[model samples]
Target: MKNISRSTALFERAKQFIPGGVNSPVRAFKAVGGNPLFIKKAKGAYLYDEDGNEYVDLINSWGPMILGHAYPAVEEAVREALSCSPSFGAPTAREVEMAELICSMIPSVEKVRMVNSGTEATMSAIRVARGFTGRDKIIKMEGCYHGHGDSFLISAGSGALTFGYPDSPGVTKGTALDTLTVPFNDLNAVELLVEKNAGQIAALILEPVVGNMGCVPPAEGYLEGLRKICSKSGIVLIFDEVMTGFRLSQGGAQQLYNVKPDLTTLGKIIGGGLPVGAYGGKREIMDSVSPAGPIYQAGTLSGNPMAMAAGLAMLKHLKDNPGIYDALNGTANFIIQGLQKQISKYRLSCSINHVGSMFTLFFTDKKVIDFASAKTSDTVLFGKYFQAMLSRGVYLAPSQYEALFLSAAIDKTIADRIIQASNESLEEITK
Candidate 1:
């Protein structure tokens, strides 16, 4: 067994200052039933914990470190930028360059605004949509997480087309009243809601390919259906591509699927592992934000030079070398196939959902299309599997609800190791 004395000590010390001894709730390991390991550093698909245990990272900072952790190019760029000071809180040439690159790469984004987090990007995009459409209500799919925004912390109430109820304590009924939800991949339900609400809906937003509810991909004609519905209803179509952006494809799912959104909210890979986000779309709609028009969203550190440099380096590498996507997807397939063999070998009641490098191994025999079906997974079994994998030196997402992110750094050798470890893990768990 790996020693965790330092990690345990740090956790005990951290809890006194930070809530649950971690910044993110999932990192607490309440779901997996263990004290979370304190990571000392990470580099290229590996996490070194304070306890001296090295883990093969499968989450990749929840889908950011696409090329790999501490990529040399990004590292050097950040270092050079830091020499110019950390935060200017003022416009820099890098921000303009970053904006230009994003607008050039993403088909839907004619104009863009930088923010600090995915939450800010999504919330701002919705606000822009509302402003553009002169409407108050918005529609989001069930089980899709856009972040912890007030309007996003919602759950489906009893009836179809009924306004969502606040899923958290702090969100008010008034905020929830303007937000509506229906099952993901259910086109008829969205159509029904649109018909019921009629002309009142400002936007229809979704994760084009969901990563939040365990990497659920859109059903056949699902994204196309949403685009048609929104176009017909004059509602802004916002693709919250925070997870899928850059990870799924160069232009994200929109480009891969040949569908264009009115707005796209981006984070994760865009910052090259730093805290950054962006929302962009059509010219007329984007022009409505800030000095260009009425809708107001500002940030002190929206275009920090350090973040821009890192993002630029990462994006440039991606744009210059398109083969990275194929490599990432190929590596993911290798790992998934290995896991598949183990499942068949053990005759396990499990199914895996995957899209490119993002995937989830659900401990259920049933297919997962939406949040409700995803919930059918046996959390107890998943917790067991997670612990089993962790003990074998592979680090997975703590919760079954989240997806496992594979980076480009997970090469053939690493993939083989993951496969071997998984096979042994399955044997141990089944025994």
Candidate 2:
């Protein structure tokens, strides 16, 4: 068995220094009720934890390590970039190169802006949209997380058609008032809300394939219908592709679904597992951002050289080797099918949703099509399953709300191991 005593000791010491003994809230394992594993290092599909136990990793750093951990190309690029400097706080040639690469790959983008996180990208895009359209209200689907921005911490109001309110404490009522919440895939609900707001609506922002509430995909023609409605009402359409960009396809969900948006926010994969975010769209709209237009947004470490080098390396490689997606999706399909077979054999109450390389297994018999349905998943069963899998050296996302990411590193051998572990874990938890 893996010796977790060292990890427990570290967590005990860390709680005195770091809040919840983790830099991120989820890392504390609050939802699963356990101390988080302290990973010493990772290579390819395996994670060597503090206790010297290795696990076949399935989370893939929340969907960034498509090429897998510590990829040689990405590592070398970061090392080369560090030889020059870290940040310039001024324009650099590399920045222009990155922007050009993104614009070239993404059909809707004529201009782009770099930011530090997904939250900044979405927040900045909304501001620009409001400024250009002269509108104050923005619509977002319920349970869709757009980072911790004050305006996005909203819940659906009492009525199915009402506006949003603060779902978390510390979010002011005024901030919540300007944000409207709607159920994903319900195009008629959005149409009615847009008709009611008319000229006051700024934009309709959503994850084209909802990952925050598990891998709930868009309904047939749902995106096309939303686009038509946005066009008719003159409301900006924003696809929060932060999770699906690059991972879904080289062109992201926009290409996968054949529905374009006015703005796209990207993160995770673009940074090559680093902290970076970007937003891009039509030149006219992007030109409205500071130095070129009225909406102001700036960052000192906007294009940190190390992050740029790593991202450029990863993007360049992926752009050149389009077959990476095929490999990743193939492995994903293999695992999904194996798990489905196991679930059927065990007669477990579960729902599995997969798209390309991202998937989620929900502990419910009903399909999780939206936030309300996603809430019905059994967390207690998931917690037991998580421990079972962890004990057997198969690492998955610690939370049910997150997606299980696949990478090129997971071969047939690793897939078999995962499948076997999952089978045993299901049996252990269900009993």
Report clashes for each candidate as comma-separated counts. 0, 0
TM per candidate comes to 0.97, 0.96
Which consecutive 10 residues in model 2 have the weakest lDDT in total? 157-166
lDDT tens string, model 1, 1-431?
Answer: 67889988999999999987998777888777889999999999899999779999999999989988999999999999999999999999999999999988997899999999999999999999999999999999888888888888875211111112328778888989999999999999999999999999999999999887788999999999999999999999999999999888999999989999999999988899999999999999999998999999999999989989999999999999999999989998888998998899999999999999999998998899997888788888888888989998999988888889999898899999999989888898899
- lDDT for each residue of candidate 2 in 56-93, tens digit (9 for 90 to 100): 98888888998989999999998998898877888888
**Per-model RMSD to reference:** 3.1, 3.1
For model 1, the superposed segments whose C-alpha errors exceed 4 Å read: 156-166
- Assess the local accuracy of residue 45 in candidate 2 as a C-alpha lDDT between 0 and 100: 94
Q: Where in model 2 is the C-alpha error above 4 Å? A: 156-166
